[model samples]
Structure formats: C-alpha cells, structure tokens
Target: MSILFGLLAVIIVLAIAYAMSNDRKNVNFIGIGVMLLAQVLTTWFMFMTPIGEAVINFISDIFNKLIEFGTEGVNFVLGGVTVEENASVFFFNVLLIIIFFSTILSVLTYLKVLPFIIKYLGWGNF
Candidate 1:
C-alpha cells in the first residue's frame, strides 16, 4: 500500500542521513523523533481542524481580492485589447498584478505609510 511505501521511504531517508552524518555518535534520536512527530501533527492540524481551515480561507480570500483588484486595473486600460489563447495573455494578466501592487507600494512609500506598517508589524503590535 501507499502507506507502507511512505514508511519505507522515511526509513530509507533516515538510514541515508545516519550513514552520511559526521557526528553519528552525537546524533540525538529523541530530537529527530520529536521533530518528525511534530511535522505529522502539524500537517494533520492544518488539513483537519476548523480553525486551520478558517485561517487558510481568510488568506485565500485576501489573495483572491487582491487579484481581482489587479484585474480590474488591467481591464480599465486594456479592456478593448484582444488576444489569442496561444499568445502571452496569461503573462499580461500576471504583469497587471505586479504593476498594481507596485503602484500601491510606491504610493504608500511616498505617504510614509509603509514605515508605520513595518514598524508596528516588527513590534508585534498587530
């Protein structure tokens, strides 16, 4: 089964690491086991918990909104421009997002808003 293969892969990787390690005598097995267990638990928590789902959804929503705003700006200027599917239409779309983000960033920097945001974020006030 796939689960058996996954376990085998983990064991093989650990064996290779142990073989290549310079300080094999000082290798802390307890720390390695704890970290592996933490990885598994963190993976499970992210995909299985409602709070994790909400966190993911919130970030997704923010990204989607930003992209939507970018598209709006792109369409405002190039709405009449037509392109074929085999061309660089997708490239232009991505470029629009970057352009919109840069424009906002420049404006924020000019207004000294970025420093305020960075200062508070650095201080963990948010």
Candidate 2:
C-alpha cells in the first residue's frame, strides 16, 4: 500500500511538471489523468484502513450538519411548515434542495476550489 501511494505521488509530480512544459492538449490530458490517479490512490489509502471508518463517519456527520442547516433555512423562510408532506410540495422541496446544493457547488468552484483540488492532485502547476 505504501509503495502504491509512493508511486502515485511520483506520477502526480511528474504529471504536473510535464503539464507545465508541454503543449496545451498534453497538459489537459495530464490534468485528467492526475484526477483519476488521485481518486484511485485516495480510495486505496482511505478505504482500506481503520481510518476509513472514521472518514466515513466524518463524511456522514458533515452531511447531517448540512441537512440540519438546510432544514433550518427552509423552516425560517417557510414559517416552519412542512409543506413538502404533499407530492407537489415534496417535488418543489427536492428542486429547492438541488438548486441550493448546485449553487453552493458553483460558488465553491468559483472560489478556486476546483483549481486548488487539481493542484493538490499534482496534475498541473497553475
């Protein structure tokens, strides 16, 4: 496992260096490759260990907190009435939830989270 991670780390760094010195197309491919590598490496490292259990718990806790926050916001704006008990209202609530999450995602990405993530993946320099 450690050897695998070490190799992945080396690949990521090399990819970033290549991206910096190569053509745009190669850089793009390198970026994609790095993302895939990061996904695989993280899966191998995190899911195959005891820490994986804690990581899962932490992720669940975060989602729970987000749900609680969303519920509070909805209640505040809708006078605390659970109108989504009806089918139409339920669909509307689902749409609202999707939109809320989408907007949050967009905002975070716009704030350069995506770029930072790519950088951390070590696929590209800038």
Per lDDT, the best of the predicted structures is 1
Question: Local distance difference test, per candidate?
Answer: 0.84, 0.74
Count of clashing pairs, candidate 1 = 0
lDDT tens digits, residue span 1-126, model 2: 998998899789877877688576545766567777777788887788889878988999998887677767777877877664445776446666666678778987999997788778775443
Worst 10 residues of 2 by lDDT: 83-92
Per-prediction TM-score to the true structure, in the order listed: 0.52, 0.51
lDDT of model 2, residue 52: 80
Pairs that clash in candidate 2: none
lDDT per residue for candidate 1 within 1-126, as digits (tens), equals 997999899999999999999999999898788778877997788789998788889999998998888877777788756666778766576777898989989999999999899987667221
Model 2 TM-score (2 dp) = 0.51
